[model samples]
Target: MAADLERQVAHWLAAARTFRDAEEFASLEAWRAVERDVGAPLRRQLNTVVEELIALGDATAKLIATARYDAAALSQAAAAVQRFRRRYFQVDVTLDFIGDAVNTRTSPVLRAALTTLDRLAVASMVSVLQKANKPVPRVLVYQDKGTGASILRAGVRLWAPGAVMPCAAIKIVRHNLYRPTSLFHETGHQVAHLTGWNPSVGAALAQALGHDEELRAMWTPWASEIAADVYAFLHSGYASVAALYDVVGDAETILHWPIGDPHPIGWLRTALGCAFARRCFSEEGPWVALQRSMETRFPISAADTTLQPLLVRSMAAMPRIAEACLSAGVPALNGRPMTDVLEPARVSPAALSELERTVGAALWTSPHWRETEGIRIVALAGLREAEHPETASVWINRARAWLTSEARAA
Candidate 1:
């Protein structure tokens, strides 16, 4: 059965590639070459398949837009798709199959919900930054984990391995093959990255604002992860909470680290996702309901306690960062704002204290926290402390001294 599935998938991929090549008309000569190479019958068949795939994608979008909240249906569909993709594709064809599924699924309610959430999130971000009319053109929806690793690998191989760059296209890795909400979460990252909306501030916060060790550890890539989470939270609105938890839950079950993958663990990633979701949706209505869902589903822990103060500090500093961007006269892309969208829920001192206690407790015993969330907690704490001038100066001095001492010892 597996062998047969693999053969079918290979044939489909080959046909798809041939169709894609023939369709990409570069010049008159290139067009002629494609025509000569593809022949008439194959070209016709390919075109038909391409059209069918496109129509399928449109139909799927509509289905998601209209479907009622049927968890059982969603779960079943997701599982079925996963089984199909796993059985059919060799070398982890999970992403391509899932992407195709999302593109082809037909749920109008889901589509409508996604559209509404996308608009509100984008509007809020733009409004807060005072760039009210920017045109954020596209949001790619991807399924998480299987696809995420592929994306990370592909990005590294094609662009720069171990380096971050502005991706040309927006792609979403869906949380589940069937449940496509993570599409919105990834869309948030795509929009923010493409627009130059929040990348600089996020980088600066990770670098200049973090503690010495934290800065050293996280300065390279953590900013992108955190920024993506923040954007996902703001743009996803209330629906984002469930989508995020689903992704995290799926990741916890599926993703594994053999040695050197840079991404944090599934649990920590989910915790961060939940924290950001709470910040965005803690207010009222659907957003509030989403927050409650996260609490009930994921359950915050002691490690999360450390995140409280960091979240507060970061949230407080956003306005100032926006002011700095405005002062710098950085041009907005398509009239979008230059500011970080502030979530309405303010971080309380009590919350921060509780978070710290929770993190400390979790760190002491739980392998999950110690191996994963603990690092993030420390990194976040350092980042928070680095934002204050006094603390930053102290940290900088200590870092310089440490570097000098290491050099001498060497």
Candidate 2:
């Protein structure tokens, strides 16, 4: 049994060595040549993660060799080697995700555009970490087909591997390729994860909305989504909420709340978004119009008995909920309010209009604008698309052209 286990341990160790550069994983070995590549910082991160796992495998191999012929000792050694093998496989899965993302570069320009836009959103949010002297992770974005966008956040344990995800791997849908405010929402996940914003927001909601037990229960559990939505709104203004409405569909979806799901009901979510705009920007802007539109489009009168009262109560509590998200003191950020870290007024209608007016037509033509204020440009485009229904295609194309060029430039 000892001899058999020794050979198996050797095989596991051998497999781990394949993680080294120019070895079994083509994603790590030839990562740079993969389309335009995920860039230098991510390449370095990939290399570092590979080295650490390889070192762990080496330690496991050394420990197994010292086990000799003792049955109990060999069993312990085998378990250690098994752990090493499992982590080795986890690394493989991570690299494969990166490989898949880069592979999509071979698809339409829209795919690459979504990826670029995602990275910009991530970088914009991660700037908070950089400000606070915290380490930032490299980001990877891939285009996928889905009704909604999602994220595998950085600086957190991955879904299966339990390994710290090295990069913010965001999955943006192909449909919303032009206006991907969902990218900001996903990066908000990373930001909230790293800065401990979710729990902080939860605490704030509990304190502020505790007067109504049902409203407290409904919104408190949905803290993560609320934070992400606020992050999206701060970066993109009314358009983020409008884009959310576009994806969430009819009255059935807007009013339905599934217990234990992290997302609040669509009605509350959109209403809270308008509340955020009201608190941060002008009260009479597109958000008020959006709330009125939601009511008209998905009337509360159609709601069933169970959902009817809950939706009404949730709607009334939105202003307070929005205040909690905006003003929550996060310990990870050294107890600073979210508004202190991320200014909502930056993306307000007046500010976005001023940005365009100041920059002239160069905002669209210049990659510098895409580099410095790409996040706001996406917001401006989405807001313009909402405010001016006729020029929607033009604004979308302008953002698309800038994004495509930025992707190529990167």
Candidate 3:
């Protein structure tokens, strides 16, 4: 039994070493490139975890050679190696995601935008976590199918506060330029995963309800969604609101009718989004205009009476909830609103009116457009100028180049 166990240990060590040396899984050149683009601070997190795996293998090998060679000792050593092998697989999975992320890119303009977003988001994660004296939360963004965006966490649970449990994968749509606003919403999820903000926010919402069990019951389901919505607004302003409309503005009443779903009803989601916008910006902005339009389309009478009051109350509390969440001083990370980090150009009324006039004439020429708007605004501008698909695509491509150059300069 001892001999057999020793043989197994040899095999396990060999396997671990093989994995450690493998090139196809995570190439050295690839990681170096990522390190350059993402910076060493974030890259170091992955490298440290990887070194741990290699050290585990070394320890396993040392145990078999130096420790007692009795049946019990061998058996214990073998089991330890096997356990690490399983854990190593988790690390392997994350590396594959990162390796792919390093190599992925689309068009020049869009790729620039995506890369900028990744830098800003990861930098924000590092800054905020450091301020709170917490572990660094490592996040990477990648492209995938579908219209919206989503996040994949590394471990079963995010055990450390502000640590992405090992890493977090942000999957963004490939070509849905108009709805990239969803990226802000997706960033909110990454924020929650890193900070475990949802549970904290949920508790706050429950406490704010003040023993109103019924409202509390309704509020808990939508806490995370609302938090994401509010965060998106802070990050992208009216553009985020516009993106929300593009994605779920036409959602059925049935989708929101189920109190069990994590999201509030479609119209209610718009109302909450608009409400958050109101708190952040003036009363006469694009968000307020969108709120009125949505409310007109889907009034409280459209929803069941039981939900109407709850939805209304939820809207009323949006401002306070948003302020409280931000006051936690972690949402934007680095204590700066996303607007500051993003440095989006605000389109003046004159510029917008001029854009409208140009679009009407089907001459989507890039004017000496001085607005340093974010990618979302540029995308929305392209959509609004849509006289045809080809024209929209051309305009968006130009807009993307402009935004990307501005981001690089910043």
Candidate 4:
């Protein structure tokens, strides 16, 4: 039994050393070429967690080696090694996701387009943070199939204790890749986090609801998602709303709002988006058509008894919520209404049309135009596709050309 205990300790001692080798096994050099802003911060976070884990392995090896222990003591040492092993796997899973993000350049088709898309996010963030004079963190766009699009925002706690994410790792779906207003929506989440925009919008929505306790409670929690939606709207205008409507699917999806979900039900959500567009642009084409499509596809009169009233009341109050969201004072914007800063008018259909005409051939070809107007051009393409479904391929190819140019310049 004494010899068996010694052998067991030796086994774990080797296991612990093997754990330390995980840091080098991945050969993180592939990530070395990531933009310095992205690479530097990511390396710091990764190093902090990895070094601490490596140090633990060293300590664990020392503990098991230096002691001659009873069976109970040996069990404890083995358990310590097991715990370290578990923690290592957690970091490993995180690195896999990060690897997925940074290794996107592996494929030629995705490399340029996604790279330029990453730059678009960085540029948009810079525009947002300029007023506050905060440094813009880098963005990494990776492809994944999941609920619409999502972001793992910078500064959020990650797998390892005390490890904060260093950049916005945005997941972009393949179908929406060419017409990705949802990119703006995910980036909007990071913007809201950085600017502290969510709670402020929640408070304003709550106050605007006045005496309606249930409605106030319902909408207040939705502020983060709502703020992101409006942020997407500001940058992409009706394109965001149209993309949202398309993604929400048919009657069943539009009518269904899962409990405890932070998103407004599609019923209220579509209405709110269209309302915001009308508020900003003062008239609506695609927004109104989308609202009608959502409404008539699944009429509320036919909805379940419980869902109908929530829909009606929320719809009635949506314009007010929309008004408050865009109109309310925001300290983050130095008390300017969001419209003043984000300038929703810039992406409005009329403005986009004029931009399309003015930029003409340069819109697709000019590097200067790509840098300045790439985000808007994407919105224009998406909005046009929504309006004239026939033009989808033309616009997609054009956007792809623009993105390819951006990558070549880089």
Candidate 5:
């Protein structure tokens, strides 16, 4: 089932990249024309798969919601809910350029594209979960400002009505004036929570580090974000990485840290993402081999190597941190083992190779590459190397060249 979900995710990512690349040289009309040429067959396939999954997800959710509770039943149902949430409620994303400037308010085409993308993302997520034999969630995607906050509010409201556990809602905000990848990164957080991959390590780490502001700030820090990146890497592969880069890296600036939040620094996030991917695929998989090739092609800096120590330290302290949080009465930090939710699955070398190839191709062809921020490129380069060291050196060289050229132009 896990293999199936991974493969399906790979397929959707490939198709998405192809569409994105095709659109680069084509206008809106041209892209639409191509979709017309191909959309029918694709849509038919997509619709059929999606509808069946939706029904399955709905049924599963109902059974769990109403079932009599025994310890075994409760455990099964909890696990089922976790799986269903991932299958039914994961977000599918597409980015459209509104104009020379990203003007969400004024861009009719962008708005329309966002709406279509949201619907497709929802459908695809639902179908993939069902394919994996998991139940689905009731999902809603918001396109306006404050989508995340609003969705949380709606979830609270639904809880009031005693609707099946408050459904997960995601907001797919446009990257009009800011980096779109940041939004995706946040979405990754939402996905991690729903999918049950987010490590229950933050609170543990915070407690271990002591309860100062720094520790409090670190409480729900990059562990969740990093987990999401790893999930995105495994689930969506390179296109997911590319999408992240596109949204976070700006063509005009060296780096534009997100304006308002205290999220971990972006470059670090990217680096950790790549590292996690490498660790996941380093074994005997073709995907691992390909990732090895990519990594070797793209080497990162020595200074950045420091992240490994931090990650290790955090990982080691996680259980202790969770224990501390539990003792301290922080409900959010109470431990819930992710392994209970996500069944273990292996990615064959072939699968790893396929993912690397697809992601490499996507990175080369992504429209946002030229415009992406330098730090992000560097971080991704590191991640790619960590995942596929064979390819890292070459990829990093290419990245460095791009960075140099951009710097020279600036």
Candidate 6:
């Protein structure tokens, strides 16, 4: 029995030692210093993870030191150490995923554009949810080096003291500012996950779907994706829709999918976004054209026949689903919908048009034409200049400068 106890204590010590080494490697002192400045919330959370590992190690060491070691006690200590090690490893993986949060490979214009987008996306949510005493979630954008479609990831499962540390990973097609609008869509994912909107939306959607179990099951998987789409629509309007088309517009890829896929068929998703725009803005020209463009571009025949009925059912329920989601969502204004919060008076068409005319006439104008303009409006202005790359670049540059300047001036 005594020999067995010794063996168990050695096992516990080994596990604890492994955790301590991984903890040190994961949160190196020098790297933590730089990350501390990048994100205090994440830094604090990382520190806590490290401390937990240390405490577990110390406790196990003391257990091994005592001349008396019971089998049950040793077993419990070993189990505790293994459990904490698994959690510590998860935190470590997240830290590695986030890395240094700096990229020198991107150009000034593209880097600035990314930084501007990140701020705007965060501010959009903060403007709404902060009033309800929710901390503004922090998102970090990284230029992805891997192949395949651009991806957005978040550590929604990361354990932390208060609220799972909301960290977003947005991998962009590096140096491609034209597609920056996707950032809003990706950031929307973070918002949906952190705000607990998916389950709320699922319950509300289930209620909306009524006795249709098939459609409900189909739509539940898509709750978060739809929430993100609606969020993008409320924030950037046409820019996001246009960006969506650019990314998944191909017929073959956009057409259909298995039930496990998180996003609905691309055509359906695009139509839903257009429907949201029409309902909210009531604008006739580009918004109407966008819906027509998506439908004409990706015909319904491209959608998988097996999933078509479910997709149709989901599309039918989307308007009310969107309305319900927004109604019960974090009110960014005086209980007004997030659309109102994102597209207020300052970013009204008249404001954007007025700024465009003035800024267009003189390229070197004060550049603060729409100092109070929301990032969405500025992004729209940038989109409007798409015909002229130089002008578009100027708008992007001004947007970066404008956004950063305001952030500092605040």
Which should have the higher TM-score, number 2 or number 5?
A: 2
lDDT of 2: 0.76
Point to the candidate with the largest lDDT.
Answer: 4
- List TM-scores for all candidates, in order: 0.37, 0.80, 0.64, 0.90, 0.35, 0.68
* Residues forming the 10-long window of minimal summed lDDT in candidate 6: 29-38
lDDT (10s digit) by residue, model 6, range 194-284:
5666676667667777778987776667777777777766666566665676666775677767558888767767776666656665556
RMSD of each: 22.7, 4.2, 6.8, 3.0, 19.6, 6.1
What is each predicted model's overall lDDT from 0 to 1? 0.37, 0.76, 0.56, 0.77, 0.39, 0.56
Kindly list the per-residue Cα lDDT of model 4 for residues 1-410, writing each as its tens digit: 34443465455445434533423433344454366777778777776777777676666655566445545566666676677677677776666677667765655556777877888888777777888666687898877776489999988888877778988899888788888888888888988887778888898999989779888887888898988898889989988888888777666677876889999877777788899999899765778887887777778886778878877888887778899988755566786666777888899899999998987887888878878898898889888888887877787887777766645565
Give per-candidate clash totals: 42, 0, 2, 0, 48, 1
Model 1 per-residue lDDT at 354: 55
Better of 1 and 2 by lDDT: 2
Q: Which of candidates 3 and 4 reaches a greater TM-score?
A: 4
Q: Candidate 4: where is the Cα deviation over 4 Å?
A: 1-33, 69-76, 406-410
Q: Model 6 clash pairs?
A: 128-332
The TM-score leader among the candidates is: 4
lDDT per residue (tens digit) for residues 371-401 in model 5:
3322233334434544565785686566444
Q: Give the C-alpha miss distance for residue 38 in model 3, angstroms.
A: 2.3
- Show where candidate 3 strays beyond 4 Å: 1-12, 18-23, 26-39, 62-69, 106-111, 120-139, 150-169, 175-179, 186-213, 220-224, 249-254, 257-263, 277-395, 401-410
